[model samples]
Target: MTASRFLDVIVGVVRQHLPAGVSTRDLDGFMDRNRGLMESHIQRQLGGLLARLPGPGSASAEDPELPELWTAAKRTAANLAAMVVAAKLGAERRNPTAQERATLRGYSGWGGLSIEGAASKFPEGFPVPEARGLIHEYYTPSKVAAEIARAVRDLLPTLTGEEGVIHALEPSAGIGRMLSAFSGLGFEDLIWHAAEWSELSGRMLRALYPKLDLYQGPFERWIRERGPNWTGRLHLIVSNPPYGARGAAVAEDPDREYREKRAYAYFLRRALDLLAPSGLGVFLIPSGFLTARTGEMLTLREKVLRRHHLAAAFRLPSVKPGGREALFPGAMLVTDLLFFRARGGELPEVDTADRGILEGSYYREFPRHILGRELGQDAGDDDQTKKPRWGYQVEGEFSRLPRLVERPICAECRITPLLKELDPKLARNLRMGVMRTSLDLDGDALAPISPAPPRSGSAWTATWRSCRPARPRSPPSSGASCTRRCAPG
Candidate 1:
């Protein structure tokens, strides 16, 4: 039988004999018990086909056609195992029980490839393995990881004085995806270090990095106990840390306190502390880090934003798969390399004007390009500009975080000349309307009352009339008529 036919037969037999509601392990055990019979069937069918063609010693099996058949047979066998596992897992729901997970983990070794040897195995291609069993999560697509790595690599030379050996660290390295990209960038003798909390994942990383220095434990505990030793040593750090919120600890401990902070924030603070005087760091962080109002987020921003200048941020197109809702929208956050420099170190003088640094603006409007698009608006009134007359200026000419953080004020408050002509009560209502629609009050109001100040034109009368309560109106000629109209129904 051909490989497809052979697979069909095995699948048919499995479907016929598979126990109802059988656990994955039990199904695997059933297959194992029948292994001899299955192999015999496969070998007999393949042997007959080989006989019809040339023998291995003869020209038939040696023919290119025969080799393809042999390769297909191996592929089919692998696919058969995968299909069986998938079907069994689907039937069971949660990942197979611990025994099944362990069994699958061990069986994974049968079809594994070395990460370093990947390029050679598929000489004409990028060698990313197919998602298999539990190893799927560890695999970061090479194309995406390479793009992020290149962005970091471009910034690293500036931070490292153009020609120094750079020591990089990835806290949750998982199968070395980011590290592989780092190695490709020509860092001399890259001292790759990683930590894996999962026992199976740790084994996989060790296998991939035989000589690599690795620590296997919960990241927070590892950092609290061991991080100080590496302080002032690392030159670069990058990571795609875990996404789930840290759970309440079983016991009250300092390490639990460490984990209580979002892992990425903790890693960021740690990277800043560990970095060499002239080091650089890039992180893949949730976009919430930019606009978060929580105390932890505010504190994190206060510390990093003041010290580390924001170099670049790429708001990536959503690449997360479905069912992974907890994974926050990610952006590539690049911070200046100078943040790690020692006090009074010889540093390059940055032109505040040329670099586009100013109060109430961010660097996002600079000439920096991303994914082939220029950083900011082109010619027309782009979305970023144009603040509401009743609201604080939303978009400034420059791009910087510090410039944008401002408390909302009633537009009619007479503390400033700008606020003197506007109606504070009307502005407050408009602000409330903006908040109700989940829009920013700074500029993009959902229900804009008036295009400009009410005093600008006769159009303001219609706008004012629209906002008036639905109760009875007073006589038109008196100013009291306007006041009574403005009162809430």
Candidate 2:
């Protein structure tokens, strides 16, 4: 069941049926585009084509990258849809109304080794979990997990009783590192649901987050089969989905832009479909999703912008070379923490420079060194005044609610971007007054009503920018001025 072995067999079998001179590469693209659909048909009609192919052979038991699980993976396709369809019918959605946000204080739990601490139960020689087609399994760091949880907390509705019980889903829960962030946040009535393909990872996750509604299978299957049941109904989705895997299928966003085989892109496109209209999604994906120049990636970006408002974005440094860094323990895959809200973000001008901050050009490049320097002048190191500490540490650079441009989040809610703490504990769930935001919208666009908006959890420094009208009738006095109203996105 090795990928190369199976690939050769599948390709050889398909070649016999190839029409005319269409090369395998061309057919490869065609198959890749329709892989999801093909897999669906195979799941239902497994006997015809699959039965002809050879079954898996005995392989080394000690293989780190074991192919033994590949046989089980193929068998999963047959019952994947049945498994999701037979699961608890339609997913219940949770939405709350009108909450205020007093203070958005940041949390400091990075030192806890949240990712490592949760996986402390795994034995030293535990085999890598690849049964779920997971080629990349980097755990989310605690600092990153807390930041994602903080963003999710902002968009949550303050529902009580049955409605208050938040129905949440994490597409991939490796040992519950990200799931634990949901705890201690005021949302005590959270119903956790997660899908992990590896039995080993599932066992570890179950031990860590007892409340999780665990789905032990590939995310593509669970999301594709169960997504419709929860279509536009889930309150929140937080995940650090797998990266760089192929042959994923999803019923949602069947278009090629959404179907590109990049595992992160495929997972995000489908998972996003299940988000409640006012729900929030916070994911950690490769920066390529944000910066890739490919046409498919570009289309995916546009699709996201058209539907959801890009709220907050942070580009995390990749793992330092030589693997001594304590952050991400996998490949040097530069990642970004992206927060998307149902609505109410300033639209960015495509192809334009800094005007549209979310535009690819704005984030065309990022610092790649390990992030060790604390943000802002508050970092009390004696050499803080020194310039170009490049070799010393990499500064964290991010922006939150950085939507101040030609079009504001309506005129009333438009306030100066202030540097504030991120810990929600310091503040009440404050809601800004309801106001109609004016963004280029189609028929279904709702006036963006946002909560205590999510802020850039990792900002190198905060500068005051005015959100006043383009042409001010009267300039404010020097001492007290409304000029420094908002911060740059």
Which of the numbered candidates is closest to the native, going by highest lDDT?
2
Could you give me the TM-score of model 1 versus the true structure?
0.41
TM values, all candidates? 0.41, 0.47
Best by TM-score: 2
lDDT of each: 0.39, 0.44
- Which regions of candidate 2 fall more than 4 Å away from where they truly are? 1-135, 154-162, 248-257, 319-326, 344-359, 363-489
The residue pairs that clash in candidate 1, if any, are 54-60, 277-341, 360-403, 361-399, 361-400, 362-399, 362-400, 363-399, 363-400
Superposition error at 24 for model 1 (Å): 58
| lDDT against true structure, model 2 | 0.44
Predicted candidate 1 versus true structure: per-residue lDDT over 256-345, tens digit per residue: 323434555665655554554435566655444543345555555555543344545543322222322111112112112111221111
User: What's the C-alpha lDDT at position 288 in model 2?
Assistant: 56
